[model samples]
Target: MRLALAALVLLLAGPTPSQFAPAQAPAQLRRGLASAEAAIRAAACDAERRFGEGDPDANASRCEGVRGPPGVEVGRTSARLRNPRNAPPGWAKAYLAQTDGKKASEVEPAVFDLGDRVGLLRPIEIRKRCLSCHADRAEVAESTRAWLEAAYPRDQSFGYALGDLRGFWWAEAAK
Candidate 1:
């Protein structure tokens, strides 16, 4: 009985090596990417919907107030993301160049080592409703246009149609 008791204690002492190791690298990466992507979209969509693509304060809040989902730092590739720090990695630029509007949301979340750390980029696109605010200068509401001009002096996040590439949501994770 003592031996059995000791054995039970030993078994419960700590986690197993396999448990410590956890899932394999690829699986972990996939899971991480999926979670990160979901988080990013949730935040971005909330901001976008709330702002209605016109309110300077709303947009600024998303850009400046919210850094991103935990470790992830999300922004647009153009003046949209706007911050140099939020710039997409080199690989993402290349991948984005090849990604079409239809494929933007569907593109496989790419893993990239941006030297500082590993990150995942999930592409995002402009939906039809988004074009109301993101469309050509002529199409945008006068009030929205004025707000955009006043807020973003060098704004380039315009002239997009439905299904256009607005930008991407990038999540930076520790290496």
Candidate 2:
């Protein structure tokens, strides 16, 4: 009878916050983020090879082949956004500001403690290959520029140089 009463109380109260929290260890979270990042890079590289570098369509293919690992949320965001949907959270904006004028190789991944969760951020650098799509309007292929305009009409993601800090890839998991 006591067990039955406890069950009823739990049912009425619904799941506790801890129940919704990610239970992965910090090491597991790191591993998951690394795996997700590798998958995304591989997918993007394959797409670039198949569709020709700098094709907006190729860029879009990256997400099609990748999924965020279970128990964590992963995404990319930039201060100069092509997609407003990729805007960084409040905490991330502060990190982004710190990356200004720094090369990806020069910056280290940032880790954060959020009371109930942990967050990790890695810098995304603009490489030579990236310029085909992310360079100045005059430098990018006209066709690619046109596609970006049509797809992300308010795009502000251009004008980046090789070795520049492009943005960040971040992951969050409950502690």
Q: TM-score, each model?
A: 0.57, 0.64
Q: What tens digits encode model 1's per-residue C-alpha lDDT throughout 1-175?
A: 9999978865765432111111233554555555555557667766675755455565554455443346655555632542456665554555555564443445555665444344566556678777767898899999988987887766766778776667777665543
For candidate 1, the per-residue lDDT at 94 reads 50
lDDT by residue (1-175, candidate 2, tens digit) is: 9999979966775443211122343553554445545544554455456646446565665555554446666677887899999888655666676676677788776766555566666678887888988999999999999999999999988888999888887666665
- What is the clash count for each candidate, in the order shown? 1, 0
Highest-scoring model, TM-score: 2
Candidate 1 — which pairs collide? 76-81
lDDT of 1: 0.58
Positional deviation of 19 in candidate 1, in angstroms?
29
lDDT of 1 at 49: 59
Question: Quick one: RMSD of model 1?
Answer: 16.9
Off by over 4 Å in 2: 1-68
- Model 1 residue 173 CA deviation (Å) reads 1.2
Best by lDDT: 2
